[model samples]
Target: MKIAFVGKGGSGKTTLSSLFIRHLAASRVPVMAVDADINQHLGVALGLDEAEAAALPAMGAHLPLIKNYLRGDNPRIASAETMIKTTPPGEGSRLLHVTGDNPVYDACARPVLLEGETVRLMATGPFTESDLGVACYHSKVGAVELCLNHLVDGREEYVVVDMTAGSDSFASGMFTRFDMTFLVAEPTRKGVAVYRQYKEYARDFGVPLRVVGNKVQNPDDLAFLRAEVGEDLLVAVGHSDWVRAMEKGRTTRFASLEAPNREALTLLHAAADASYEQRDWERYTRQMVHFHLKNAESWANAKTGADLAAQVDPAFVLAEGAAAPQPA
Candidate 1:
């Protein structure tokens, strides 16, 4: 299963994303935690020492290699200019299995041993001061999406992503990428507003948006979220002194997190791992290409436009008996 953590800024999405990675790893599940947020704090949230986290490689740094590998041996994709997001994979195209034994992981991923469980970590390189006007962060996000496109997750394996906060996800097709999008809303008006905006947008993509209330200090707080979000609320997390202590530098370990947090996480995991509606690959690819073309026309030149269009896989089919399409 693949999951993404998203919410308004400062809503604790990173903390929850990091905790989810720890939970999956500690359970002996094969997991990859992606820091797709521009802030790039998922590393520190995962409890990595500053130096160790700094040493991790950024996926955006290897865009050339990623494009090369993903293009693979396909005769149709003759040049990077023709490689689109949905480009079909042929022999030599790297595919990531849950076991973490693939060229993608080997080439771009860094190993982080948390507790006794081994988890792989990858980041979208932080936006630097030099990139102010010349670059779009979506390029890195595109790299993440391309990598995810090649992965095939099974029962024991999982992918967790810490997405950029708020409606910024809509800038690309990223809102459609995850099997589950865990919205970590705090019990506040601003948080609820973000929830409404995200939920409205995700409804168009048929994405499963589960609301997980964070920093619930009392019944009133929980009640506010419940009233605002209603049935979409999956779980509510209470304020935790343990997490506060960790934030204050009183401890470096997360093994002894408060029990309520653990319980909330367990419930969230159960929901994530549960069977949900499958997405239509054909429609998804087409919509992705449409967005690519739109983006290309607006900014990218002709060659980049062709490259984005070329990534579509012509053989994609919508699975029968799949969940009904969500109304756009």
Candidate 2:
């Protein structure tokens, strides 16, 4: 199952995402964590030192190679440069398995130690001086979007992405790529404001959004979240000294996590599993085709000088045990 964590900046979405990833790993679940945020701090949040995290390969920097490898032997794609980020897979295209070995994973993802367990991580990379004035962060995020589009994950395997904060995720079809999205919000009007915005936007698409309250210190905080989010409130995570210490470079063990905070992680994981039962491969394929057509008509056609619509295989369905269509 694929899950995403999103919220307004400083709402602790990244922190919560890291904790959930560690929890899944500690339980011996196969999980991959992607930092799709502009800040790119998930590695550090997951226990890597700043220097070590900074040294890991950035997925955004290797988009061309990723595109080339995923395009596979598909004749619909003229070349790697012709494959835009929104290009959907067709017959002959490579589809990835979450727990299977593939070149794309080898080139971009790295394993990092978290609480004595290894967690695989990939980052969209930070925007550098070179990207100033000429590029948008969305371009870097395209790498993550493409990866999810091509990935075929099982119900037990997980892909947890820490998405860009706020409603910025609505900028592309990427927001619809998750089985569940945990919106982390603090108990404040400003925090719930983003929730309202996401709720309104996600309503049209039937996005499965649930609110996770962060930094809740008392009953009043929980009440504020319940009032603002109502039934959409799934869980509330209290402030934790252990997390603060870990963030400040003080080594801390997961076993030392506050009981309430630990329980919150368990709830989040359970909510994600529930979503998997409702997963629809047909809807997933339709979404991919819908966005592919939109992008092709909007810009990819002229940009690539090919009818990118040919990239969509009408018979394609991304589900377990489904046979992929062969090229005619």
Candidate 3:
């Protein structure tokens, strides 16, 4: 299962991600949870102390992996074995491999647990807000390309992508590789608005979108969210004390998630399973709007077409009987 959790800032995505991992691990199910958020809160949410996490840099670093891409085709991978942590505060594995034109293939080697079964963690690149031009663009795109390449050729059964926050370009580009998407939102107005933005952005990439609302307190709020997000596309999750427990060095599943908590997780599983199936689009259609098509036909009609210059300022178009505008 390749699952992705995405939403704007402060929407409880990290919290939900923690719950999902706890649930899967409790069942002894193998899973790889990738933390894509810039804040890097999944570890804290899982009760891995800040000092411990900081000491676990090798948990997600890959230097030799980067060298392979620079070496071109047939660069031998000395060992494809990803390092796994069996100890507490680091019950996960981190692996690294490279066979492409990406220096950041080294970055995809996320740490996971032996009990995490197939769980992996790839931290988002530490790019800043100003890195939107060619440099960062190609960098993240290359990383995304490498991620897909590795996944298509790997053995993992599931990939839980914790996406970077907001509707940034890197996040959008990363989503292009996902088959389905989960957008986490809150009952707040900004959450609703960001959720809608995420839906529209997902549509632009032709991927189906679902919603998960966290910190929801009232039934009416859930109703309102469902009404806006469509009943089939949304799930409501109440706040859980498990989040605080994890912060205190207890990487345990919240008991609250068992009965009522199970409901949301169950629904989430259905959504995640649907995504896990990996259905590829076989065909596509591209057509102009009917009004635009009609307008085009009218403009091409020699018998009834108005002077083309009428569509614009005649003086500007003619420019005193001048030539065409040159490319800038």
Best candidate according to lDDT: 2
Worst 10 residues of 3 by lDDT: 83-92
Ranking by lDDT: 2, 1, 3
Decreasing TM-score order of the candidates: 2, 1, 3
Report the C-alpha lDDT of model 1 over 57-125, residue by residue, as the tens digit.
888878777777666655656675555444444334455555635455666788788767888889987
Relative to the true structure, candidate 2 reaches a TM of 0.96
Q: Please give each candidate's TM-score.
A: 0.88, 0.96, 0.64
lDDT of 3 at 210: 81
Writing each residue's lDDT as its tens digit, candidate 2 over 17-118 gives 999998898778889999999998999998888898899788989998889888888777878888877788776787776675678888899987766667
Model 1: colliding residue pairs: 81-307, 84-310, 84-311, 86-311, 87-311
Task: State how far residue 236 of model 1 sits from its true place (Å).
Answer: 0.8
For model 1, give the RMSD to the true fold.
5.4
How accurate locally is residue 268 in candidate 1, as Cα lDDT from 0 to 100? Answer: 81
Segments of candidate 2 deviating more than 4 angstroms: 323-328
For model 1, the stretches where C-alpha displacement exceeds 4 angstroms are 81-92, 249-255, 276-301, 305-311, 317-328
